[model samples]
Target: GESVGLHLPTLSVQEGDNSIINCAYSNSASDYFIWYKQESGKGPQFIIDIRSNMDKRQGQRVTVLLNKTVKHLSLQIAATQPGDSAVYFCAETQGRAAGNKLTFGGGTRVLVKP
Candidate 1:
């Protein structure tokens, strides 16, 4: 299937350690990438995004990196906290237009240990 998927289904990290989640996509036309965090019973919240032309983007405590050559994406969370435990998803779209369809990866659950 030509869809997005995570390399790992789950990741465990110490409360104060940094965590990295990886996603792979088969679509070469995708120009926009977004990382979302979904807490239990809650909707996915946008963490960060990067354009295909850009190699990396950073948020307050998060970083999103895009590798067009390998069609890989990664999200890094600094100082992983218990509150950061959630299912993370990477989504991609061909364009930023209103009708551009967003394709999401299966998602990876991050478990933060105290």
Candidate 2:
């Protein structure tokens, strides 16, 4: 089993600006990565994802980048808004050998100021 959330990082941005959130994953074997946004008292909502074979993936207003060389991942939000303020996390999962289990990073809180 993998551990989740050892600590938290914070990101602040002004409304209509762009926000970047970073994460470091623990397993090099992890082949899939997802970015999630969680508001207070709610479960994480999926934002975007990238596979190990791909370096980048983009969604409506979000982009996910993976750097397997450093085992690092980053999420970029375009035109950040007050509604984008939330705790963002990166989750990784490998094949069935690891039960395809999902492991989440500590997470970064994004604050959008008016």
Candidate 3:
């Protein structure tokens, strides 16, 4: 399972510290990978994506690193802010030629202590 996270889904910070969230994927058949952030009571918002052909991707103050060798992925938020608090989910997409379907992993939560 690429769903590696601590329960309680929270980080008590001073509102200006950087935060690191982690995940572990279990599918070897997966190809395209993406990270999404979901705020309270809202749907996930696209963050960044990395392909199996790549190892790392970055956007704004966020950086996503992928280690396909270990089937692991991580998201790093710089200068974590109160608005960054939300649940994060790592999704693995491998087109199912049989039915054209996509798969997703469980999500992780991030709590910003502002």
Report every candidate's CA lDDT.
0.89, 0.86, 0.78
Per-residue accuracy of model 2 over 1-114 as CA lDDT, tens digit each? 222322556787999999889899999888999898988777889888788999998889888899999999999999999999888989999863544678998888888999
Per-model TM values vs. the true structure: 0.90, 0.88, 0.82
Residue-level lDDT tens digits of model 3 in 21-102: 7888888978877788877666778899887888888899999999989999998899989888777887887853544344
| Best model number under TM-score | 1
Q: For model 1, how does the per-residue alpha-carbon lDDT over 1-114 read when each residue is reduced to its tens digit? A: 222224547898999999999999879999999999987777889899999989999889899999999999999999999999888999999977886788999899898999
Q: Candidate 3 clash total? A: 2
Q: Please estimate how well model 1 matches the true structure, expressed as its whole-model Cα lDDT.
A: 0.89
Model 3: ten consecutive residues of lowest lDDT: 1-10
lDDT top scorer: 1
Which residue pairs come into collision in candidate 2?
Answer: none
Residue 73 local lDDT, model 3: 90
Error of 2 at 34 (Å): 0.6
For model 2, the local distance difference test gives 0.86
Query: What's the C-alpha lDDT at position 39 in model 3?
Result: 75
User: Under the 3 Å rule for N, CA and C atoms, how many clashes does model 2 have?
Assistant: 0
Give one clash count per candidate, in the order shown.
Answer: 0, 0, 2
